[model samples]
Target: MSHISTINPATETTLETYTLMSMQAATDKVEACHDAFLKWRLKTHDERANYLKRIADGLRDRAEDIALLMTKETGKLLQDGKMEVELCAQILEYTAKNGPSILADEERAHSAGSKKGWVTYSPIGVIYSIQPWNFPLYQPIRVLASNLMAGNGVILKHASICTGSGLLLQEICNDAGLPENLFQVLVIDHDISDKIIEHERVRAVTMTGSDTAGRHIGHVAAKALKKTVLELGSNDAFLVLEDADIELAVKTCVEGRLFNNGETCVSAKRFVITDKVYDAFKEAFVKQMQAIKMGSPENEETQLGPLSSKDQFETVSEQVSKSVEAGAKLLCGGNPTDQTGYYYPATVLENCLPGTPAYDDEIFGPVASLIRAKDDEDAMRIANDSRYGLGGGIFSQDEDKAFRLARDHFDTGMVRINSFGAADPNMPFGGVKDSGYGREHGGFGMKEFVNAKAIYLP
Candidate 1:
């Protein structure tokens, strides 16, 4: 057994130690999960839902403690972390309430008065879920709730920075009476992630991480002929039309870019504003970005927290530096804090060129890049130019035009009109292009862990 050390991203101090699972041990655990799936998946949907409900209850009861641990581990605001925990519970409850119906048999009529045909949703055996640290609780919950309620076992390989959150999730499942090995956390090194993916027991894999990691995992899963879902990177564009409510657009842009200190995969990374509203939007946006508090995530008054790790901080910093060198003006913030941890101030860049590093790169920190456009057509062109097509937002007072732009032009899998992009329990969430290939959260999320089998009567 290898020992895993947990560190606080805020202080760069050791927080806890855990026994990391070896490759052989991980294989054993996966085998156990496969065995448990045999029994667990055989249970009635209602029975499985009861287990999910118990997990939700546990999460709700310990929301505060879980939130604090999330903040300490991932360097997100305590309030945001608390919201993440609550959202996790909500996801579990939503899955428990809706999974049965979504997975129920669908009946279809025969063509010439023949027998009726039906399609059934069945469990897909063991799943390997690779989650990131940004939304530590919510990201894993999005996979775990849907899979468990759909009668599949999950083996989570969460980011090293958020191991505490992963362990807590395991504890919650065990405490909620989930059978042994039904849901396990593998505290293994990143180098061995591919080895764990190659386990024969894993039928499918899901990941929410960088594009590079997604490509590597997708390759491994493809070689094994297993199904894979990748929620990769995003350079989501936030477009502001000339007719948009300037205040609303600015507010949404600021909130979207700075939320989670701009560590979110779907956060608005690029701003494409029409020439008419460009100057006004920038002025208001810069002010809001500057007003946001930057301090410890635990403080109630704090709105921004440290980046999750030193590597992430440095990468984002380097990207900003290159963007400036490439001719973008630093409107507000462009420097990291001198204090401990990976803290960086909320930053905004203007006049960023299309091909610059900041323009195309996904900066996973509190930084926003602005791009000017001549009109809606130019805005659409700018938005669709990137390789990423995750979540995007379009702001305009003309509902018809906004709707048309969202339906016809936005390259992302999800688009929000006049509001910041978000995922709800009822709606589907995923992305197109290099952003990834799988859907998580909502009805689609449940189906990702299940196999749809067609049954026909002869």
Candidate 2:
């Protein structure tokens, strides 16, 4: 049997290793989870909500340990990991408190007469969730919490680097009184994962990762006629308008770009600043980027941590190098010191052009792309000029104008007007174009893998 090793990026050491399960064993897990779903679906929404509440409590009780593990495995800051745990717990509680009302039957009128009709949401079977290591626990929980509330079983195939986090999450759910096999983790490789998508017992699939990987999973599932929900990568833009408060925009943009060590899909990456404030924003932004402390994720004072792995570090470094070669100017913090571990300091690139990685693709690290816009109109135009549309931000002192732009003109799935975005339970998540489709959070996720049946009554 082959083995998977979980690495600590901060130390470049192996924390633990596990043997990958054989195909037969993995198939058995899918079957078992589907069996659990059969019985689970018969329970009322309130019963499911009670179980969800228990799971939320369990997450809180174990937040410290879980957050520490995340820091070791993924190199995200310990504080961010803790906040992620809280966000995950909140997602569970939100689903529990609001799911019954969201999924309750709705009355309608029959087409032929004034007779009453109703629609019911019935749970499907198993959901195969493929998640990335960046948000580890939070990534899978978003899918798991809602699907369990909708009465569906969930099988997880987390990123190979975060296998430990995946197992821990599954254990937490079962320990919190969720029935056996209702949620399972598959510790196999991609080969088996593809076959599992075609598994008869697996009814749907959901994934959060880069668009390249998301495309492959989505294709395999589509071939088997399975539904897919993918939350892919983005080169999200943050606009600094002419009327923007310079310091506010600078502070918020720095926080947005560097959060999660700059590995977030929706974090500000492209800085589209109007020419009027371009010089001021660049000067302040460069100073802030340079001042950020890059060191151990365990240090509370360390403002930036290493990339998730050596491979991630190499990728970000290479992208920056290529962008510089393509005529982008390195404003500050582009050099790598002799630091141990996979550390890459905060870097900024300006005059980022159309064809370079900085302007075109998601860098997935602490590198910012600065683009000078002619004016506010040009800033909005440039923000929309990407293949990705997951999320974007607008900074303007004119609150009404920013809101209007976000509401009517920002071509992304979600937007922030004069602020930054972290996924919220009360709002919908996911994106458009190459960022992939399908919505989570709010009440939409609970219904994604369910059958909405319309019934006509006498």
For TM-score, the strongest prediction is 2
Clash count (model 1, backbone only):
0
lDDT of 1 at 287: 93
For candidate 2, the per-residue lDDT at 305 reads: 95
Lowest-lDDT window of 10 residues in candidate 2?
105-114
**Highest lDDT, which number?**
2
In model 2, which regions exceed 4 Å deviation?
Answer: none
Per-model C-alpha lDDT, please?
A: 0.88, 0.94
When summed lDDT is taken over every stretch of 10 residues in candidate 1, the lowest stretch is 1-10
What is candidate 2's lDDT per residue for 337-374, written digit by digit as tens?
Answer: 87779999899999999999999999999999999999
Global lDDT of model 2: 0.94
Cα deviation at 323, candidate 1, in Å, is 0.7
Per-model TM-score versus the true fold: 0.97, 0.99
